[model samples]
Target chain A: MLELLIVSTLNGVLFGMLLFLMASGLTLIFSMMGVLNFAHASFYMLGAFFGFQISRWVGFWPALVVGPVLVGAIGAVVERFGLRNVHRHGHVPELLFTFGLAFVIEEVVQMIWGKSPVDFRVPEVLDFPAFTIFATNYPAYKLFMLLISIGIFVALFAVLTKTRIGLIVQASLTHPNMVAHLGHNVPLVFMLVFGLGSALAAIAGVIAGPALVTQSNMAALLGPILFVVVVVGGLGSLSGAFVASLLIGLLQTFAVSVNVSLADVFAVFGFTPGPDSMLDDLWRVTVAQIAPILPYLLLVLVLILKPSGLMGTRET
Target chain B: MKTTYVRGLAVAAALSLCSAASAQESIKIGYVDPLSGGGASIGEIGLKTFQFIAELQNAKGGVLGKKIEFVPYDNKLNPQESIVQVQKAIDAGIRIITQGNGSGAAAAITEFVAKYNERNPGKEVIYLNYAAVDPVLTNDKCNYWHFRWDANSEIKMEAITSYMKANASIKKVYLINQDYSFGQSVRADAKKMVSAKRPDVQIVGDELHPLMKITDFAPYIAKIKASGADSVITGNWGQDFALLLKAAADAGLQANWYTFYAGGAGGPTAIKQTGLNHRVFQISEGFANIPHAPAQEFEKALRAKYNVGLFYPRAVNQFGMLFAAMEQTKSADPKKIAAALEGMKFNVFSGGEGFMRKDDHQFFQPMYISSFGERGSGEPLDEEGTGWGWKLVGKIDTGSTMVSTTCKMQRPN
Candidate 1:
């Protein structure tokens, strides 16, 4: 039991941090532009593919610095030419534009990389065992991932809270006209923020690509859950997204470890449904079987009970 | 007026002759699978294999002097999309349909073809499944129009368990599979078969996660580590198969993996990445490095042409039997071909004679269990540019691979 608890907690935190790495960008974009950036994950996909290609040319070390910059530049261009035009036509158009951009990006990536997963391996330097807990040898690559995620979180927090550009960008989020009147390049600031948000997503992709499957449909796989994290964390709240990522991550990880079912609970109350009962299948379903949907369940509950989210200042 | 009427009758006769000539041009088979999306990588390989087989047959004076042409239709791996593609193929006058990526798609195509064949008597279509291994397709859901070339999940489990029964070292086993019909049946069958065969062996854990959705499997690996299982069995394929093994390697989980699809498209590369040596095992009809001279030659030729090793040797069997059936019937008619295929025995590509059971249309062949590692002296071929090859350890002949079926297929009058 102690082994399980310790292992589950560590797994949950690692997973949560991974989620935050991806969700942080979406959160940042929503806070500033309020567009939801459906194509954010697509940029992450682009990052992985680019990282794969670039690492093939140079080593992974150099590709790590180059891939995100290339994807971030592309993000900046999309904001200037694509999202900026759609923004004038209300939020729906903006949402639809990003939504369509996601498909376009997926198709383009497929055209280049084909539908199979590219072989993006962890660098040999970080491939050894980092530590052992309860007979489990956690790889150094994952430790590197955890450290990168934490470092990004710290850097992002410091940039937003303690820097001049961060203040101007935060100011531009609400008062674009005021910032423009004060002689700031408000449009340029918007573009940069979008690019920076995308880069954050790219960073996650560059790091997580080696650990995960890095396939074409990877964006779609993690897309919905990123929304759940952003919404549950409270819209536009960085810390909220962080807390929500960990919560959902822990919830899913621990849920998989638990073998309890409705039948077990019902048996405790001296009630047992027969095998042919209408809900027999439901009764027999263990918590672990439904671990994937727990985040969506939480999303629904949060929407109903706490509309602004666990840490959000605004309701969306 | 009588002269004009005679002219019109002559024109109609000429048109009939032209239509008759067009009908003998080619024997078009619809290759319906995911050719454009997430499943495309494997699907395209299946397509290429069929095309290669068709070309080989065409080079041998064609089947009954009619060229074998595979018309590719992208189903996107969706069941509904597959049905639509089948309909499109039917409209294009295609009489043979083949798909084998997902069991759900296979079941849908099978039902669709059966219903279509029933509704339209003369224009019947045959659905030939190449790789979907769900047992229910051969058992409860069996249909006359559908014929499966791959062994079902139950038969695979039976073979694996029998092999495990003889291996006294395997004490505790773990079952982890995708949470779906195919995955569910694998775990259930593994437990039942293992318990029945080796009662002393304890099942340490049984787990099911969402299909193809999980990106991280560390927690699952940790759970398996905690269970102290010596062996693991999974039916997971594609990314799920690759990621699970990748996670297991990262955590250094020392367990012998018994899998149904560890030899799939990207499988060898992932295994090589783990450097697990010979720990990972897969049961399949054939592998790249089968010692048979003819099979190795075919693999070599196939790799030379497409730069991809033959992943579906059963597909080679599928087409080989198909051409044989056409030759026996001496026609390209779907009904005649289906009749000839029933209870047919042929030499499979990897060796040994196998027969298609008349009761369920499930082909039974010799199933081999092989481990991935650095090639032995006897093994000549490696997979996916990896130095590691499948070293054949166990072979269950067609007789031992057989399991009783409950299929009562409805025949067309």
Candidate 2:
């Protein structure tokens, strides 16, 4: 039991870190722009593909640095030309624009890379076991992911709280007109924030691509979960996003590891289902069986119970 | 003036005759499958394979002296989209429709074709399936208009179980599959057959995950590791299969995998990355390494032309049988071709004879259990740029893999 707990907890933290890398960017963009960048995960996919291509040419380390920069540059261009143009139409248009951009980016990715998963692999340097617990080997790549995520969090927090640009950006989030009146380039700050957020998503993608399967549909696969993290954590709260990411990651991991079934629950209540019972499926349900949907269940409950989210300042 | 009028009339008559001749010389076959979205990796290769085969057949004077024209319609891997595409194909005067990437899409097309044929007798169309392997497509839900070339999931599992029974080292097994009709059937069949054949083997875990939705399989792999399973049986294809194997690799889980499609589009790369060294196995109708000279020559030619491996030999077999039926009947009519294909026996290029059972319209042939390993001296093929080739480990004869089907067909007189 202790071994399982240790392994599950480690797995949860590792997965949660990756989720935070994605959700932090999303929540930051929401907090600043008040528009959900639906194409955030798509940018992550672009990062992986770009990284894969660059890794083939230059190697993994260089690709890791170059891939996210290229993606961020593309994000900046989109902000300068595309999103800025759509901004005047209000939040709905911006949301719809990003939504459509996600589809376009996916189709374009397919056109260039085809529909198959790329052969993105962990570097040989990080391929061995970091440690072993309870006869299971903990991969070095997973630990690397944890460290990278932690580093990004520290960097982001330090930048947002300590720097002059961060101060202006934070001010604009709450007082856009006031910042503009202070003779600061508010639009430029918004563009910079969007670009950085997108770059953060790209970094997550470049790192997670090999760990997860890097395919064209990868954005579609991880996009919803990132949204859930942002919403459950509170739309604009980075700390809330952080807590929610770990909560979901651990909750799902532990749930999948435990093999308890509804039948066990029924037995605890002194009830036994007959062979002809209509509730046979319910009786047969296991915690592991429903682990995938636990995050969504939490999302629904949070929406119903706390409309502003756990740490959200915004009223929905 | 008289001579000028005579010359004009002669030219007009000749032009009409030429147009009629060209129209009668071409036969259209609609290729409906996913050309976009998640299933496109497999479907694009399938479409290209059909196109390449059609071009080759046409170059050799076509089928029954009519040029084989493959009309591709993108279904996007959706059932509703497939049905709409079939209707569009029919409207364009296509009488033969072929599709087989997703079993769900194939099932929808099969049922739609059957009902359409029943409603409109003379304008009937035949559905040729080359990859979808749901047993119910041939068993309970079988239709007269549908003919499946690929071995169903049950037949493939039979071959796998027989191989497992021979290997005594495999004591504890786990089954993980996507939660869908084809996946469920594979899980059910694996459990039943493994239990029946090797009663001593214990099933450590049975897991069903959402199809194509899992981004992280580490948790699932953790559970499998905890179970102390020595072997895994999975029916997952596409990304699900690839990602599951990736998770296993990341966790350093050492277990032999007997899979339905570990040779799928991205699967070989994942297997190679795992560096398992022949521990991964797949059961299929044919592999790229099958030692048949003509088959090798054809595969080589296809690779030279398309830069893709012949992943599904069943597509080649289906086209071959279709051409043979057309030649036997000397007609492109759907009814005559269906009648000719029923109970048809033909020598396959891969060293055996395949039989099309009349009752269920299911094709049965020899299936092989192959393992991924270092390429031997004479082996000329590999998948996904992986130097490791699939080596044949065991074979199940056509007769042994046959299962009794409960299909009750209503044929058009």
Candidate 3:
């Protein structure tokens, strides 16, 4: 029991960190631009594919630096040419633009990489066991991912709060006119922030790709949970995204470890639902069976209780 | 006036004769499966396999004096899309349609074909299922128009559990599968069969995770590790299986995995990467490295030409029976072929005697249990450049592999 708890906690924190890695950039883009980038996960997918391709040419380390930079450049170009024009139309068009962009990106990735998963292996240096806890040998690659995620969180927090460029970017969102009058390029700030956010997501992808299945549909898989994290964490709030990511990660991980069901609860009261009953499915479903949806359930609860989210300054 | 009328009649007769000759040019079998979207990876392979089989058959002077042609229709792996495709195929005058991939699609196509045949008597269309292994299709929903070449999921579970009965090492088993109809059935069948076969074995855990939705399986892996299971049985395919095995490897979870699709696309690569040599077992009708000389020759030729392994040896059996039935009846009519196929016994590609069960139209064949590992001197094949091949461990003969089917079909008068 102790081993299980320890392993589940470690797994939860690691998974939470990975989620925060992807969601942090999304929160940044949303808060600064007020345009939810639906294609954020698609950019992450591009990172993984790019990382795989570049690593094949050089190695994982070079791909780690180059893949995100390339994808970030692409993100910046999209903002400059595509999103900039869409931004004039309003937030709906921008959201729709990113929505369609996700599909197009997925199709393009499928066409180039094919639908099957590419073999994106972890670097040989990080393939060993990082530590052993009661017989569970956690891979060094996961520890590296945890480290990178933490480093990204720390770096991003510092940049947004403790840096001069951060002030301009933050000011550009709410006081674009004033920032522009103050001789700052507000549009350029928005473009650069979008690119950096995308780069952060790419870094997550580059690290997470080897650990996860690097395939075409990967974006579609992670896309929804990302939104769940952002919303439950209070949209546009980086710290909220961080807390929500860990909360969900722990919730799902701990839920999966538990096999108790409503039936067990009913059994204590000396009642059992018949197989033919309409509520039988609900009664019989174990916590482990419904672990995937627990985060969404949390989303519902949070939205009902606090519409602005756990820490949002404004409602979305 | 009489001479002119006679000449007009002669001209009309000649035109009809030319039309009849042109109509017998080729036999077109509609290949209805996903040819686009996420399912396309396997769909393209299925299409190529059928085309290759047709190519081989047509090379031998064709079947029943006409060349075999496969007409591809992209269903996009949707049940609704499949019905539309099948209707399109029927309108195009196709008498035979084969599909496999999704049981939901299979069920839709089966019902469509049955109703179409019932409504249109002489223009009957036959549905040949290749890979959708839902046992319900063979049992409760079986019909005369539908014939399945692949072993149903229940049969696969029976085979795996029967194999497990022999292995005394498997004291505790973990069940992890996708949380849908296919995965649900696999879980239920595994539990039922394991208990009946080896009551001494304990089921430590039964987990049904969302299908193809999970990115990281570390949580599930940790749960499995804590359960202290020595064996795992799963019907997870695609990324589910790959990611599950990957996480198992990462956490250093040591357990023998018995899977239904451990040889699917990207499966061998994942298994090889995990270094789980001979530990990841799969039960299938046939694989590339089965020690049959003729099948191996066929595999080599197939790989040399298409650069893909013979992933569906039952496809060979499917076409073999198809051609034989056509030859037996000396016709290409769907009704005649369906009749000739019932309870027909034939030699399978993997060197076994197999037959189509008349009750359910489900083919009965020898199933092989193999594990991915480094090849011995005798094994000359590897999968997806993994430098690892499936080593045959057990072979369940056709008779032993047969399970009872509760099928009652209404035959044509």
Candidate closest to the true structure, highest DockQ: 1
TM-score of candidate 1 relative to the true fold: 0.95
**Residue-by-residue lDDT tens digits, candidate 3, A129-240:** 9999989998999889989899989988898889998788878877889999999998899889889888888998999899887888889988999999999999888889
Q: Candidates 1 and 3: which is better by lDDT? A: 3
Docking tier of model 2: it is medium
Alpha carbon lDDT at A97, candidate 2:
93
Off by more than 4 A, model 3: B1-26, B34-41, B71-78, B88-94
Quality of candidate 2 docking, DockQ: 0.54
Q: Write the candidate numbers in order of decreasing TM-score.
A: 1, 3, 2
Error of 1 at A168 (Å): 1.5
What is the lDDT for B218 in model 1? 83
DockQ of every model listed?
Answer: 0.62, 0.54, 0.50
Better of 1 and 2 by DockQ: 1
Q: Which ten residues in a row have the lowest lDDT in candidate 3 chain B?
A: B34-43
Residue-level lDDT tens digits of model 1 in B130-223: 9888999989999998899999999899888887888899999999998777888998999899999999999999998986678788889888
lDDT score at residue A149, model 1, on the 0-100 scale = 88
Q: Write the residue-wise lDDT of candidate 2 on B16-128 in tens digits.
A: 89878766768889999877655767777887788899999999999877899889898977889999999999998899999987888888999999899989988889999
What is the per-residue lDDT of model 2 for residues A129-206, given as tens digits with 9 covering 90 to 100? 899887778889889989999999999988889999779989988899999999999888888888888898899989
